[model samples]
Target chain A: MTLWQILILASIACFALKLTGYVIPPALLTRPTPARVANLLTVALLAGLIAVQTLGQGQSLVLDARVPAILAAAGLYALKVPFIVVVAVAALVAAGIRLVT
Target chain B: MTLTPETNGAARASLAVGLATAAYGISFGALATAAGLDVWQTCFMSLVMFTGGSQFALVGVIASGGVAAGPSAIASAALLGSRNVIYALRMSPVVGSGWMKRIAAAHLTIDESVAVSTAQSTPAAQRVGFWLTGLLVFVGWNLTTLVGALIGNLIGDVSAYGLDAAAAAAFLGLLWPRLKHLQAQAVAVVAAVAAALLTPVVAPGLPVIIAAIVAVVFGLTDWLGTRTTSDTEGAPLA
Candidate 1:
């Protein structure tokens, strides 16, 4: 399948996800169980994505130059650094590591 | 009938955050192009998918040699995007029930837009913040994507400039402010461990999905525990 085909499908799917908000009765989402689940979902998924991106490469997982950047990002973020600076810090750390070794 | 003098943080946030989001799009455009997408495909993804996380997920999978049109890539992006549905729900009453606003808001219901709008002190400000932020981001994102795609190779060795770490670092930045709650931090730890452990054995995208199950379990257990405590307190054994 071509990338275009995939784009079409993905776009439609994403559009549906957005439309679901207006479609689902607000009552269901307002319920405690669903609301709580929704609240927790974003954090978990984001962390999960970070781990995968940092630790894994393609099909195989390995430690690499990405580690220091992730750690730096964590530290700067904890310091309440701005988002762009946090990204720049991580990138600089990673680039420095690659330069040294 | 006029909207009051812009009197709140929402307008300021929208413009600032919209620019911030646009700055990030450079990496997305460069990455997508590097991953073998043509300039237009990269732009189209930004135009169509519109959500940052999902677009990155798609490009990430493709960069890793996974099938772009395959189930895993599509499914992963969709899952990341489904969070927008939740955003939509929270925003609906605020944006209103009209077809025009509803459709427009649906397109703009992303993390930053929602956050900026939420920070508003009034409903009028929310509507203004949401629309203004969304429009700026939409314009900025697409334009940067084009620039990035065209200048792909010139950027050269994104790792050399720390661009490679950009995605992970950005995600961590997004996650940090939310970690104030101890339970939220625990959930993040659980997810990180799960994704790390699963990455070696599972496919590229599956680990994230697998890790999300941990959150669902955590939420369920807490909910059930609260219910039980409430029930038991209501009726003591006499």
Candidate 2:
């Protein structure tokens, strides 16, 4: 498909996605189970995205500097360091490891 | 009617978030350029399908050659972006009733804006935070994508300098603030593990969906317990 086609399709899809929540009846969404699910879904999806970005290769999993980065990030987060600082420290550590080995 | 101090504070906070969000747009532009999209195409993506997660997913898919660089990538990203649907639903009531404001609200309905606005205690603050973050991120993300793309062109391959980490870092920045609650942390851990395990087996976005489903299950159980306790309590005097 052409770039325009891609963008159009993507935009339509995105608009629909944004619209779905508003279109759904509040009664259904506000239900205890569904509301809880929605709340949980946000964190879960975020975690999933982070995991894939940090760990997965094109199609495989690689336990390289990303492991150490994750470890460092988890530690930084545990220590209540700022988020940017945690990420920067993790990335720097990863880069350092890459430089060394 | 006079503007209260709270309203002013809300506006200031929203503006701050919006400006910060816009800075990220430069990165998005740079990454999209690096991934092989033209300027107009990148701008178009930012303007129309303004969600960052889906946009990043689309570009990532294209860069990796996981899906064809057309509707398939968009579809995958859109599926991954379905969570925003839920966000918009919760936001509608808070969004109030002007056509212009509604359109603006739709454009600004991203994760950061939604979170910031929803977390606010008052309605005025929520509105201010949502619009400010949304608009700021929108502008920031697009401009940054362009900047990143231009820089990418100059540098040849961004991977050499680890420019790819920009997106991941930006996401981490956003995610870190939300990890305040135990349930949120547990959900993150479970979902991350699930996604990692599923990545090898499923398509690009499917792991995220699976993780979301798992989170939903956990949330349902939690909600059920909370409801049971509330029911049992029967409005006891505080």
Candidate 3:
């Protein structure tokens, strides 16, 4: 499929999933099992994304400036720096490392 | 004519969250274009997908594997978006009845809207919180997304500014706030390790999906024995 097709289809699918919650009987999916799994799965997917974005290159993992940039982000987050600032600092850290090395 | 203090508080909180979330649109905009999406495609995604996590997931996949990885990109995005289903379930009653209202509410049923609405004390305030936050975020996100895409188009090399690292940091920031529980921490560790290890062997987008499956298994089995009912209750805004 073309990018446009994927975009339209995925958006439709996402919207349908959202609508399903309202139309379906709440009891059918309100169980503890599905809810628990969904929560954990969300976190896990995000964790996986962090790893992939930072370390993965093509089909392989490579160490790069993203690693330290992520660390810098974590540190700024620990300090309760705002989200935009955290992102900017990470970019600066990565760019500085790239420039020096 | 005027809102009660409580209602005002909810509205204020909603706007704060909306603005905070909208700030990420610039990153999404820049990164989407960098991932090979044109400016309009990136803006369309912000307008249509309208979910921060899913939008980032799609662009992230494309960034790594290019457009040919469209299937995985969609899957990853849809998977991330599945959380909105949970939000919709929680929000159904809050939205009351009316087909038109439900349709519009479903579109607005995102993390910030749900969070702000549920935090309110009264039903009227809840409605205000939900709609205000949702609309504010939608407008702000799209506007900033256009800004980011335009900047991305003008910038010759995204990597020169370390936007790649910025993307990774953005995900890390989203994940960081959810690391309160030990079980969640365990899942993060295992999933990160598994994804890193599998990236080389598996197809580009498959590793994250596999990691999600791993999460489901761990979540269902209560592998770490730290799972509790409370842990599944709330999700922070993305």
Candidate 4:
């Protein structure tokens, strides 16, 4: 499928998921297992994304400027920096590193 | 208009949270463009998906894997959005009745809105908070996304700006808040390592999904066990 198709399809699926909560019987959907699984699944997907964006180049992992950039981002996040600032600073860090190297 | 303190407080909270969370849209917009989405596509995503986490994850998958990973991208995005279903279940009572209201509420059923709504003491305050936050964020996020997308398009070469790194950082920021517990931390570590290892062997999108499955299995085993920390400790997701 094309990216546009995927985009619309994904949006529809997400919307369906949201609508399900309203349509489904609340008592039946309140199980603890699904909730816990969903929560942890989010964490897992995010972690995987972080790893891929930082190191993966197509099929290979390469060390580059993104490493320090992400580290700097983590540092800012630790210090309670705002989300937008963290992202901007991370890009700056990576760009700066690339320019220097 | 006359308002109770609770209603006033909810409004105030909603404004603060909405603006703060919507600010992240600029980052998401830039990253989505850098990931190869056109401005219209990016805006459409903000308008239609309407969920920050899922939008970012979808664009993140495309960034790493390209259009060829469309299936996995859709899966990741939809799965990330599954939380909204749970949010909706909780929000149903607060939304009251009427198909029109329910439909609109479903569209606005996101992490920020839910958090803002649940923070209130009364149904009236909760409804006020939910609607206010949802509308404010929807508008602010889309506007910022447009601004960021234009900037991204003007920049042309995405890597020169290190938006790739910025994308990683954004994901890191999202994951950071959820890492207070040992189980959560362990899941993150295992997922990261698994994805890193699998990326070279499998397709781009498959690694993340596979790693997620592996991490979920590990997490469910409770190998690292659970901690007694409060679930509400972290800042709400954008």
Best by DockQ: 4
Candidate lDDT scores, in order, read 0.73, 0.64, 0.84, 0.87
| Model 4 clash number | 0
Q: What would the per-residue lDDT of candidate 4 be over residues B1-238, giving only the tens digit for each residue?
A: 3599999999999899888987888988888998999999999999999998899999999988899999999999987887788788988999989999999999999888888888899889999988999998899999999998998888878788899999999999888998888778888999999999999999988888888795568545656656343323343787
DockQ of each: 0.61, 0.49, 0.76, 0.77
For model 2 chain B, give the 10-residue run with minimal summed lDDT.
Answer: B229-238
**Share of native interface contacts present in candidate 1:** 0.70
In model 1, which runs have C-alpha deviations exceeding 4 angstroms? B6-9, B157-162, B223-238
The regions of model 3 sitting more than 4 angstroms off are B225-234
DockQ score for model 4: 0.77
Interface RMSD of each: 3.2, 3.9, 1.3, 1.5
On a 0 to 100 scale, what is the lDDT of residue B30 in model 4?
86
lDDT of 2 by residue, B119-210 (tens): 67888777776776676677666776677567656765644444445445545554565565666678788888998898889766566667
TM per prediction: 0.85, 0.77, 0.95, 0.96
lDDT of 3 by residue, B69-184 (tens): 88998988888888788788888888889999999998888888988888899888888888889999999999999998998888847678888998888888778777787777
Task: Name the lDDT value of residue B118 in candidate 2.
Answer: 69
**Ranking of predictions according to DockQ:** 4, 3, 1, 2
Residue lDDT tens for model 3, A4-101: 87788778878888898889877777766777677777788889999999998899899989899999999999998987888889989999999999
Tell me what TM-score chain B of candidate 1 gets against the true chain B. Answer: 0.81
